[model samples]
Target chain A: MLFEQVNNKVVRAHVTAQSPVLARRGAMLGYSGAVAFRPVRGQGGGVGGFVGAAMSGESNPMMASEGDGAVLYGYKGLYVTVIDLDGSYPLTCEADRLLAHDANLQTSVQFVGSGGVRAAVRGAMTGQGLFTTLVHGRGPVALLSHGGAFPLQVTGQWPVGVDPQAYVGHTGNLSLDLKAKVGFRDLTGRGSGEAFTLQVTGQGTVYVQASEQKF
Target chain B: MAGPSVFTAQSLPDGDNVNPYVYSIGLAGEWFISKGAMLAYYGNIRFEAVSRYASVRDFVAAQFASPVYVQDWVVAEGQGKLVIGDRGFDLNAYDLDDGNLTIKASNLLAFDTRLALKQSIVPGFVVLIGTGRFIASSNGPVIFVEPPFRADPEALLGWADCPSPAVHHDAAWMAASFAGALQGALGRTSGEEKQYDFTGTGTVLMQSSEIARADPAVLRLIEDQTRLLTDAQAGSLGQQLMARVQQR
Candidate 1:
């Protein structure tokens, strides 16, 4: 494994000439051996990803670490969760939740599928934006959450409901439906703060943190 | 390290904590929860504003009596495993068996509908009466201390079976600041001169950290307290508030 967790809040990545790591900018806590860091635009997601990130208004600056040694990475004292992908499914995550991923991983940007207006409103409310970043191929991706994150499986029988603010990302083929239980009382400032929820269906893994805190 | 545990609907804990920062409520009935505290849930569940829920279930109105916090709370009904969190703070559930506990409004995440909530005379705090369980968040693990000690206002979580603390000023610091105040150097607090002094029998709950969350009800509570001020005093207070804003 190229990346491993030092603790719940830190991850150490062994960087080599054959395998480099792209991490969120300013996330380097410490490093060992001969490693050099360089700025990467659009998170190395290429032009399409850059345009998508720009249109969605999600700011994610990235840095590339190269050389032979290990690099320690973390951000804002957030708990870190390492996700190992087998190239069977793509991981769709908020750009801000992303900490580090293998440089060889294929990256792209995609809109939160279907549900249109409701999904858009949910994104705006959660401040996650409409477009989400996708990481593909077999590698380890490090994600940051307020508390440590856990995965919930979405199957054919049970759809998962999640607060937009607590949502981290997801993997697999899935559909997202935004549901709001707002009533007339909500208009009078007596609304349930949990008026909106994102319903995930299909076979996939959804990541949720123990907090509604937006970074 | 092993990957995180993957929980399915059936595997999610019922009325247990998912982690130190998350609690899962086994929801068979109704729970009064803070607005936006829910992280996720499974099964059939519905959330109604406290005001609207009162119309359908009149007992709800009687149970939740604090008008200042009514807008910030909701009634979650139906069967489901509801998960809640509070900005990544440490979440701990406490059971009050026929007892009362007063807590900071922002730290009280969710409580049972069986408990009646009353506004505490102390600003920004609420008293929960009756026997029920409640979930509260602290910046860190909650610490229990006996009375006869002064607590930094920001670190205090709440007090159970105890009288409300008295505002105690540092005597030597106050004496030094009195001369400065007489020289028109108002607002000269060092941020540590005043504390909540507990003297009677009871336990005080405190957090390891001193960071306090902003309470939305504080505005209304302070506004209500303004009724004690005269028109001239109100004008002066407004100007002082404006000056503080400008300084910020």
Candidate 2:
């Protein structure tokens, strides 16, 4: 395990003075030897870039951990899955789920959520934002899951519908459409709380966390 | 070293779980899945409210027997693999070969239509009979123990082929001298005084911890149990319930 799992819920990224690692701000639990930490804004650079990322619903503050030591990156005891972005195919993740990645990865915010008038209504109803964080040209990226993250493969023939709250991210050529089915029981308050969901279609892999994403 | 593995729909496992929390069911005809348990799916599949599928009325009648929690389940029909997850609990699949197993309603994620389901005598549990496979979630890995044991009510998931346990309490708590016992029943006692005493010869299933997801069907279960109370008793219980609600 190059990026070794110190435990089920934490990962220690091997680092030296030359090759540093980028991680979530406030996720540094501890470090041995000398480690230099500097807070970085979002995918963008400084204060202006930070505000843009936030307004666009892609704000996930990060910290650069560099120098001669192994830095522990963790968040609230969440389980970490270390992924190597081979071939730089691009990886997308929920903002809160991205724990750490190679500092050289190209990170940006992609608006994969609802758009226009419908976006506003759905956003208000579902309490979901309209952008996801995209990391490209990656080496090793660590994702955090409340319980754990699981992958579901999707082919074009059968579209996958997922609970918006449980969805963390997806890859490949996938298109998303919001779907809701309000039945008679829903009106009587006896319905399952899954009246609204997201339908993803196309050739791709969808990653979802086990627990519902609470607002 | 190779890169992180990428799973395609064709490569995903069939009739099993993809991870500790996600179970992928390869569906051809139908299966009963708990409401809101579906996370995602691939291939052509449609999830209809358990009560809304009129086309499969006979099949539904044969397979789904619990009318009490009907609103908390759905039928996934068609072709493809459907993925379901439950509040991040570890999921395990069990096979019943001409056997029966009773499971906590909240813990059951999905079950093949070949198994017939019925409401268990235990208010919050359901029993599946015949040959089929079912998926269930536990707070942690399930611990199986034999009978002649006592378990905390919250940690008891369900049991198989055993007589229902007798609700047991500490002798001191039970002998709270009539009036003291009445007060204790009304909600003033140490939690440890209560447990379920199982004396039969069968396996008992228990979760590692007492932590459980909030079950909304409890209100309906209590309402059904209230049918036994006399009018006077109902009124008295209603007042007690109101007082408890207001106190909260």
Residue B214 in candidate 1 has what lDDT?
A: 77
Model 2 over residues B85-122: C-alpha lDDT tens digits? 88777899999999888888889989988998898877
Among these predictions, the greatest TM-score belongs to 1
Residue pairs clashing in model 1 are none
Model no. 2, DockQ: 0.01
Which candidate wins on lDDT? 1
Model 1, runs deviating above 4 Å: A1-215, B176-188
**What does candidate 1's lDDT look like per residue over A72-161, in tens digits?**
676656778999998999998888888899998977776763457877786776666777778989999999888779999999998899
Q: Give native contacts recovered, as a fraction, per prediction.
A: 0.00, 0.00
User: Which consecutive 10 residues in model 2 chain A have the weakest lDDT in total?
Assistant: A119-128
Look at candidate 2 and tell me the lDDT of residue B41: 88
Interface residue Cα RMSD of candidate 2 after superposition: 18.1
TM-score of chain B of each: 0.93, 0.90
In model 1, what is the error at residue B216, expressed in angstroms?
Answer: 1.5
